[model samples]
Target: MNPYQAPLKDMQFLLENVFDANTTWQNMPAMAEMVDMDTAVAILDEASKISRDLIQPINRNGDEQEVRHEGSKVITPDGFKEAYQQFSDGGWVGLCGEPDFGGMGMPKMLGVLVDEMNYSACNSFTLYSSLTAGAALCINAHATEELKEKYLPNLYSGQWSGAMDMTEPQAGSDLRNIRTKAEPQEDGSYLISGSKIFITGGDHDLTENVIHLVLAKLPNSNGISLFLVPKISVNDDGTLGEPNGVSVGSIEHKMGLKASATCVMNYDNAQGYLVGRVDRGLVCMFTMMNYERLAIGIQGLGSAQGAYQMAADYAKERVQGVAAGGSPTGAAADPIIVHGDVRRMLLTIKSITDAGRALSVFTGKQLDLAKHGEGDVQTKAAKYVGLLTPVSKAFLTDRGLDATIMAQQVFGGHGYIRETGIEQFVRDTRIAQIYEGTNGIQAIDFLGRKVTGDNLATLSQFVAEITAELNELQHVSAEDKSAISTRFDNLLSIASHINDNKLTQPALINASAVDFLDAFGYILYGYYSLLLADKAVGHDDANFTEQKSYVAKFYMEKVLPKADFHLAQVSRGDSAIMDMPAELF
Candidate 1:
């Protein structure tokens, strides 16, 4: 297996040229005091090392060893404990956490890139830390000041880890079906009782304690609420006390991410604190859920990147039948990369992954503006964040899986065998499309709520912004610019068609949801690819700049056409899909 090298050059280019993180940071009052381009570069450099040297080395071994379930305790695989210690000790867990609680307080734009590096190294190993960071965000946002003071510091510092316990045997994407119960107690706490399944980082030895953000309903109330439950009790002085009622029923043996503990957690009268107001737990959970959705998308992106590196390197070295144009090296057989089919697959992965990275950074910038900017800048940014969040999750993971499968094809028979490690990428990435709210659900949310629910107002605003930016670019060719503009217009037309007819044809949005999201994704990728190329003009590194232009052109010519096909499907409406009765199957 080829070593996973963080795509640092492309990352730096996107930050400095495409998105201009320096200008963004300088403008935001909250971030200007904390980061500059040089500081961000240094941080990324260290993250790359930690990912390459520490976490990645244990990836294969961790998968083979898997997490052990002995009695009620779950034990992580070998080297996981050590690697997590170093990762936490360096404040990597709190890289983008609150500054008041001993966090580094970096921008999400920079954090998303760093996350890609760590996830690319090892998915299983990174889950423990990722969950912790997410839980801290939820607590910081909605928890009481006392709760924040006590839990935020440790959760951010990585001394303790966090888990999101939302799913049960009955409830997955639908949180309304949750059966967990929270009863009020005299000490201003609630006693939580429930069994939650598929809890990632639910129980692990990597941290001294596990803090769970659980969803449960109060007695006699149908409305759900959020609670903070810890594995071990904490005394007034903040020292560890006796074991709480929280216990791991068992660990799930999964298809991939084997080293990460996915436990079936059972809570029996566990003492818990409410996070946010009553009957509003779902709102609070969204704070963390939205963040996790994007992170999972990056998980898919990182896996595709790792698979591409291995496949591309293999194609160059693995000798196969002679190329149609003859071997460049003049040998009995040429490397597989000399074949046109292999070149197509590799280029497809490259073009999609590059644009996907740009999209992630763009979405991250919106999240930063929403959090730190004031007035209309903040309001508009929040709207964009809501609109882009689902797209970022669904589209990126959907493409991520496609890219991995294509990269595996480059390896041929070697890909199927476990030793080559390309198979792992496929298996690991499959979950990203399934978990964090399945891609199908994400599509519905995008089209049904985010787009049609607003009567296409938000979608129009986003499209107009992209169009304005594309019109301003001077380096891109007029033909390429026209292609992008045409698609933008086509997209709005389809959105309008759906919006106008959705009232009469109730199933229009639901049936057309996936196709609409897919078309939107391809169009957005096209826009970002051209934007990247436009930004790369007159760079000091001629080779890098030229490659960006070439990839952008290829994506425009080959991949952008995918939008038309999906749009055609959307035009078909729900007839073919909904006409078939469920009982027929």
Candidate 2:
């Protein structure tokens, strides 16, 4: 049997029951008319069918037949181009774009669910469009009116694709070391030169033109700048012209996600136009970076969901052990689902995945509010988004990789084989931890910038909110509340210690950042799962409500305890990481 199934019911429960996205939309003017329960459900249904029916079938094939490069042109797998067109034709590309630019302008909350579905179906296939969504966000936020008018419509329609060109050989994470140069010309455009590596969808035959948001250091500029470098130069009338001086050097052969093209692009005197302000390329790129970071987290969520479906299904059918209740009368042995350890593995995957999805969707709601809410509300939402962005990026992806690995173990030797498909999940999920800024960098951003850096007001507010909820739950029996409350206190104490010590040393902050990220993520997920339980209490669906309560208890007892362990490590500071000599490795 195919190991893929759309978790539509669970997704709907999270959206309508836990979050009440419908009510949230009713309160927001910008999204009120555009999204309702019916529309949201319809969108989800269409996305699921497209993902399961169309995308999942090609997943293994795409991986097997990886993108091939011959001479200057690169070729996608047989069905990719047509599938991309189908995705575009269905208007799926603009699920969350601005309506003014020929997009549906749906709320990001809904968009994120669609993203998770698509990723779960086929991460490599979904990335081609994901990059477009991200690049469009950057352009819409920072580009000029003409640039927006000219490009946003086609981009939103998916008639044209987008790529973000930031990395070079020497400048993967360090933007300052980039050697790509943009020389200003008399026609108000800059001539871009240098090579960019690991450019996803860099040069594909999927669309008419590929819009590259290139990052290069311009001469006589104070710092790096962003440029819009298209594959084919366009005239003022929006007609295609000669080829821009950009070419694909080659594509990389990687461990997984081979369906997606990872190209090394060479720009030799390519005509380009500055995107944002001079020397403000980093700032503009960050607009895309922030969104992409969260999207990567969703990628993790997708991988976990995909892996869990396979493992859970296998456990329910494969008979290898005796049941706790006793051996089945007619069967050779009971299914592995009856085994405590196997159940533990599956539950671990489910509990973490469910919480991860809630956290990600919550963040997506914050993104929507930040963009469309009122003055102070918008500012507060924006700050909250900033604070949670890194945690979601690092912790979710890290857990996603872990979860997939555990799920693979469920299949035993079958998982190791290419035919079983579990190994692909492991490979596809692993990259989420490394890309979009390695989880290490994400942790540093969470601790140093979000927590330690004078942004304490936002962090404090978040803690107070969670504390209030914990206090309310305290009325429950002491035994019931102990794990939950202790986890909350542990997280609060760590945040308080970080604030109190005021460690100005970057080294210390950098070293302990991953611990901080893990602590924050676990505590945050615990809080969200508690909220889910609260919402699930009154529902008439006994099975669903009971599942929610069980997951909440599991999170408090099993998952939340990790916060204390992380805090203990964080309190020890960065000496262990810093004191290690380079030669010791």
For each candidate, what TM-score against the reference? 0.99, 0.96
* lDDT, residue 175, candidate 1: 85
Residues 437-546 of candidate 2: C-alpha lDDT, one tens digit per residue: 98998888888888878646778788777677656753234554555566656666776777766656557777788988898787777777777777777677788878
- Overall local distance difference test of candidate 1: 0.92
Predicted candidate 1 versus true structure: per-residue lDDT over 1-585, tens digit per residue = 767799988999999988899999999999999999999999989999999999989998988899999987799989999999999999999999999999999999999999999888899988889899999999999999999999989998999999999999999988899999999999899999989999999999999999999999999999999999999998877999998899999999999999999999999999999999999999999999888999998998888788889899999999999999777778999999989899989989999999999999999999999999989999999999899999999999999999989988999999898888888878878888998899999999999889988999999999998989998998988888889889879889988999999999999888999999999999999999999888888888999889899889889988999999999999888999999999997
Cα error of candidate 2 at position 98, Å: 1.1
Q: Please identify model 2 stretches exceeding 4 Å from their true place.
A: 328-330, 470-482, 500-505
| Residue pairs with clashing backbones, model 2 | none
Model 1 deviation from the true structure expressed as Cα RMSD, one decimal place: 0.9
